[model samples]
Target: MVSIRSVHGSAQLLLDVTGGVTDIVEKMHRTIAREVNPLNRLRDMTGETPVAKQGHTYRIIQSTTSLLKQGLHRSLDGLSAQEEWELSPQSLKITAALNGVCGDHLEASGNPLAISMHLRNSRGEKLQPGSTSLSTMIPDASPRIAVLVHGLCLSHEYWKGHNEGNLGTELQSAHGFTPLYLNYNTGRHISRNGRELSQQLQRLIETWPVEVEELTLIGHSMGGLVIRSACWYAGELDLPWTSRLKNAVYLGSPHHGAALAKAGHLLTSVMRQFRYASPFALVRHTSAGIKDLRHGNLLDDDWAGVDQDDFHPDYRKPVPLHEGTRHYFIAAAIGKQVWDLPSTMLGDLLVRLDSARGQHSDDLKKLSICAEDCRVFEKLNHLDLLDNKVVHEQILGWLA
Candidate 1:
């Protein structure tokens, strides 16, 4: 067993390693594309160069950068069990920088990033209140509908994977459940939002002015945890709506928590000084995201509550443990086959098979997966759980 301190240390190492190789990864973006105006701009600012002449310099910079990034990602990807998930602030900064650079260049070239961010957040998007639609709020009967919650760092659009997209839309269309896309800043405190979500679910159940038949939930990654937290609160409330939990499925939930998240907290604590220099300090620490991430894992101070004007309703304390045995049904996906473990765990890139499962207690009463048996998706990764067709088809078929 690794100590939390060691977990932090491993994450710090991961960050340091990733940070050192960031420029290279960014270079990969510059390369493989025909554009080279940035190189001309850099040269003209410092010296003088024709736009045509800038291609060579751009290629050189991009070449060197790509090699470094490829090497780095491979190394990070190759980390062993004890260190696989660790991330440092340095790594995150590198990742953030990579994200910014990629997003900026892509936009300049008239291409937006993938994943359409249609929904606002857990708070819901702006809609005129008076007029109602079927998707907005079901009418005339019990509003007991299907609500869809997305995973961490993702949007409600995650569920609408049609043609290699998420299945949010399909759930509404095919499953006959009112799909409510739950989106939030996953970097925030899990339990706090859990309560807020619980309140939201309670309101969702009560407000529709109709009888809710079954409140089915499907969560991926951190979304799974949030759903569980909400359900735990609802069950405790003993409300009829709470009893409507008919089917719940988790794609790749880390029921025992991810080693990587905890490791990331450690990385920031170590490099907070050197990296947090100057005005980058505020944006780096707060707007950039470490503040909330650290707080979520109970590592850094609570930034959302203290700094970001966080708001969450209070409820009974969560079990803080996965005890899905009480649910009407539960299902989870495991991508890796036993023969491929250590080298490849058929996980959704981020979540592991063991952690995605329930406690090893030899009792079905304590089963983490609510299913009498689970469907193991042999070759899917974490992202594939949402994007892959086979996985979605299996889910739809099973539910049907």
Candidate 2:
């Protein structure tokens, strides 16, 4: 259920968006007003006066909008003090997408819309790691555990869609491995989420009702990158959960980088070079998570001091697969056959073939995955990797 807190957060976000659009529109109007006059345009072109001074009319409009927004904000605050309300499934989906786009900003601004990292059951109930109630939450807990992580703009409930829920049931029935789902804000940096996940997993293992003999991690798309990041952090911190980890599976994961994210970065960078286009670029407010996807960044050092808006080459440090654990990679293509050009160039429509396979032009950055350990399914797009029965069967076969 959506709470009163979320309602207020949504209202706040709407006001912020309205304010931003008003500012942009004002700038655009000013630019147009200046350019319409030849003398002003000439001055702008010569850099003598790049921006025209704000007119009295523009100031009055901005002031009026600001006042109106402030009034709305106060009203929303009052509404927020009311009893909690239930959030519908549709609202939850929208909130997840919003988080993926600007989750870092939401968190920084203390917006209640920001999703905190947590483990959840299929019913979407939060499961506190190390809590005594964990056994009650998962009564059929097993010695072998498989934790499923979803991709960007998604919640733990994603696994329960399109018959994919059977993956968990079958895993338990076939292998005596209990399944758990990880729910988190996908807009945060992968390294940050990874660090938190490492700690969470440790607490889970320490508090598990049964003695854990094996742990398997399965992730799709960005979730795979998060899992890899968590593994790296876990090793660095010497977390005990790392000892129980036996297998890590990556399905349609961009180990090197995603193609679409790089394209977006390039597009925005190019736009920032021109004055009129710069406003549009500013409108693209991508999160740190989206920026990290440009080159599969999984460390703080990769982006700490760099300006994301400026064009920069890939500078991510290499993160290797966890030692003492078997790794598997699954890739998909939209084409009907592996030999098809589309299959080779545009695997899964979002991730490229080589990237999903952890292939890199530079040897130092390549993942040392075995040829037999990687599988590519044709005629499958990115999201299909999550729901397809073939993908699930392949996962089971590898675990078996």
Candidate 3:
């Protein structure tokens, strides 16, 4: 069902978008006007002269937009009487995509569209730790637990493909491990999710129906970063769940950083230099989560006080793999072979080969994953790593 909050959130987002576009158009007009008029241009360039005045038409448009926004808000408040309505699957997908883009804004505005982190069953039902309902949900719980985390903008449902077999089911049938899925808002900072995941895992372990003897973590893309971040926080907080963790598998994870995110940051930075282009840059404000992917930020300290849009060198603190856990990394490339240019330049079409393998030129930044523990698959894209039989087999092999 679609909550009333979603409706209110959507309305607010539309207003914000239209308002931003209007501002952009007005700014562009003003910039053009200043350029065509030498006197106004000189005034803008020099502090001694007064700034150019805005056009009367632009002022009228701004006032009209404000009035419309206010009216919309008043109208939406009336609909609050109806708490919820049917929400389609297509709408869910759109909401997830929106969260990936501007989740921080939605969260800050208290929009119900923002997703919260939770543990879900294979059926996509929420699982609460330290509750009898957990045991009721999974009557046949096993001693060994395998926690699977999906990537950005994805839910636990991503793991269930049309294929005959999935990694979770295969693990259950072969290794006697019970599989659980972690569903979360991919637009939040990795560190924040990580900290929460750590606490959740602790509660799950403490409340498990059966004693958990071994724990395995598997993550794809940004999910892997969250797992790493969680492990870091677990150590700092001395969480007992860490003791049960034995294996960690990273599938197409950008341990160093994602190439596409870096490129986006660069483009946004360049666009901000021009007044005409600057407004366009503001059209799509990326979330703090996406910004963290620029350098695989796993700690709050990485971006606590820094301006994300400004060009800054990689100053992220190095976080090595856990001491007692066996770490495995899987990297994918679009090329037919590992030596191909595409494989080296565009690993999986999103992450770079070196970054996926956690191989950095700087010794301090490197994840130091053993060569034997790392595997590279050619001719596969990023999402392909999720359901491909070969990839599943490789993960199973690593866990074995």
Question: Evaluated with TM-score, which candidate comes out highest?
Answer: 2
Error of 3 at 92 (Å): 3.0
Badly placed stretches (over 4 Å) of model 2 are 1-3, 33-86, 163-165, 282-284
Query: Positional deviation of 177 in candidate 3, in angstroms?
Result: 1.8
Better of 2 and 3 by TM-score: 2
| Candidate 3 C-alpha RMSD relative to the actual structure | 3.3
**TM-score of each candidate?**
0.52, 0.90, 0.89
Q: Model 1: what TM-score?
A: 0.52
Where is model 1 more than 4 Å wrong at Cα?
1-144, 235-240, 266-336, 342-346, 360-367
lDDT of 2 by residue, 1-400 (tens): 4477786687767766776777777778766768677688677655565354454555676677668657756766666656564456678778889989989988986677888898876566789988889989988778999999988888776677575545766678778888888988999999999999999999999998899999999999999999999998887898879989999999899988888988898899898887687777863587888888889988878789988778888888888888899999999999999889999888898999899999999888899999878999999899888878988889889999
Model 2 has a clash total of: 3
Error of 2 at 267 (Å): 1.3
- Report the candidate with higher TM-score, 1 versus 3: 3
Candidate 3 shows a clash count of 0
Candidates ranked by TM-score: 2, 3, 1
RMSD of 1: 16.9
